[model samples]
Target chain A: MVTLEDARRIIAAAEKKAAEIGQPMNIAVVDGGGNLVAHVRMDGAWIGSIDISIKKAWTSRAFDITTQDLATHSQSGGQFFGIHASNEGKVMVFAGGIPLKKDGKVVGGIGVSGGSGEQDSTVAQAGEAAF
Target chain B: MVTLEDARRIIAAAEKKAAEIGQPMNIAVVDGGGNLVAHVRMDGAWIGSIDISIKKAWTSRAFDITTQDLATHSQSGGQFFGIHASNEGKVMVFAGGIPLKKDGKVVGGIGVSGGSGEQDSTVAQAGEAAF
Candidate 1:
């Protein structure tokens, strides 16, 4: 179980990376249960991405994989082709969400938005590295 | 505007109140735009109430009124009879939701669940008192 302190650390790391990249972001952190633990929307962050960020974190933790990887697997001919429609549109198969694992088990997830896919992925990676 | 710090403090206060009341809870905080700012589910908190808690906060901010008040207005023959049917059922008319006001403006909201309505409202008030 990821402690609240751990969630805070992950969010701080992600926020630092977002700042370094000059992109305001909405970041979400969710525990192993796919429940939100913490979230931060930086100044000037897009309001529309708030739910997306939360859902991205949820999707990452729910599937125990990075959303970027999920994006690839969810392609038209892939195993999870229609997975996006499964969770009432909460499944975000994109580049900004990453799972946080401890001892080979997913402990939590971090999701980032308000930037390009690459930028979002980079910031999410920075957050995942905290755990 | 409720800063990230304010959201954190609200959740923390709510958590403290829940602990004192011996109830594990799911708490949610939302900003002025009815966007989620932070959330926390204490260990042993019911997962079923996660979305409910969030929606409660959203409903509070969306209408600038407590869910308890909304419940009254939504009662049979009340001015808002059937108001619960609006917003795709995201409007939670209950006691756990309260708006956070600052400088005479609704700045955000806090929602709590996992206990009786009275307990939930008490914990939510502890959070709202933060601002």
Candidate 2:
């Protein structure tokens, strides 16, 4: 189970990394059920990204893959094209979302926003390390 | 005008109140534009309340009235009976939301869920007071 404590620990690690990189962020974590466990928007993070962050977390878990990978198949003429229109508009095909795994099994997900795709992915990876 | 710092302060106060009452809760804060600023779901709070809390905050700011009061006018046969069906289901006519006013003008809102109507409103009130 991805307990709330685990979510908090992950958020703290991500927050620290974002601080070190001098970027504010919106971070979210979801349990195996793809339900939100916790979320935070660091001061100065874009308010517009709040929804994107949560949707990205859900997309990562719902597909059991990093959103960057999903973006590949979700592009024009790709296998999962138009997937973003599914899930009532909750599917986010982009970077910055990574699935959380335990014992090599997908257990949850993390999403980060407020910077370039590479920056967001780096922060998300940092949070995953805390899992 | 509700910065992330303000949102955190509001959430902290609401969380404290929820804990004092022994009810884990979902809390959300929204800026004047009805955009989310931050949200948290206490360890054991219902996952379902996560969306509810966010919507409640938006609903309060959208109408500039406490959701408790809005609930009355939103009931069947009342003036705003179908308002909830509007806003793409983002409007919540409930008792857990209250507007955050700055110098008598609504500036933001706070929402609390995962308890009885009275409990939710009480917690939201504590958060609003912090602003």
Candidate 3:
């Protein structure tokens, strides 16, 4: 159910990690239904990453898979080639999204952007750990 | 959280109003997360109206304002002139959408289409009344 409070906590942890890496990032969380719960764009984060962050969160929960993994299959000639064109172009098939699980079941998702894929993934992982 | 039942009720009311006005219409509802909950297209409704209806619902909730009012600020040279280009084209700055409120706090939105802006606004208002 990813209550707003829970989203805030996750975002806090993600923000901290982004800070540790000296990357201003955009972070977003989505509930079980792949609906946005909360989002934050750290000071100095790229404004363009705002929508990407939210879409990445949705992509994570929409498929219950990290967008990093989704990217592999969404590339040219891959199993999910052209998947990024789906969901009104809201499927962000790249790094920085991780599904939140409770009792080993996906309940929500977190997404981070505004940095290199690895940096984004690191912050997203921090957020997932919070959940 | 605008439950499915609530969306159904709102759509039903909007449909009735559209019928009364002799206008087949497209109606949509979205929850607090700006995610679609329900939608309906009456017989003879414009197919193009379907997407508009859904986008209107999402826009209302996303900005916590009526799309009719959004239209005002979104006009050329207006305060939000280029805002429609934001939100990945999900922002519909026109009539036909209204924010749903509970205890003065926005909880969801309803959108209607398939007629003039005034007609759509009327139908949307009826849906809002139901909530």
Q: How close is chain B to the truth by TM-score, in each candidate?
A: 0.96, 0.98, 0.98
* Each prediction's whole-model lDDT (CA): 0.88, 0.92, 0.86
True contacts kept of 3: 0.00
Q: Which ten residues in a row have the lowest lDDT in candidate 3 chain A?
A: A35-44
Number of clashes recorded per candidate: 0, 0, 0
User: In candidate 3, how many Å is residue B75 off?
Assistant: 13
Model 3 lDDT at residue B37: 61
By DockQ thresholds, what CAPRI class is model 1?
Answer: medium
Candidate 2 local Cα displacement, residue A95, angstroms: 0.7
Which candidate gets the maximum lDDT versus the true structure? Answer: 2
- The docking category that best describes candidate 2 is medium
**By the lDDT metric, which is better: model 1 or model 3?**
1
TM-score of each: 0.90, 0.93, 0.55
Error of 1 at A65 (Å): 2.0
Candidate scoring better on DockQ of 2 and 3: 2
lDDT of each residue in B19-131, candidate 3, tens digit only: 89999888888778776665566656776886789899999999999999999999999999999999889899999999999999999999888899999999999999999
> For each model in turn, which proportion of the native inter-chain contacts is also found?
0.51, 0.71, 0.00
Q: Which stretches of candidate 1 lie over 4 Å from their true place?
A: A76-80
Of all native A–B interface contacts, model 1 reproduces a fraction of: 0.51
How do the residues A1-131 of candidate 1 rate in per-residue lDDT, one tens digit apiece? 87767877898999999999999899988888888876778877888888888889999999998999999989999989999999788999988999989889898888998888999999999998987
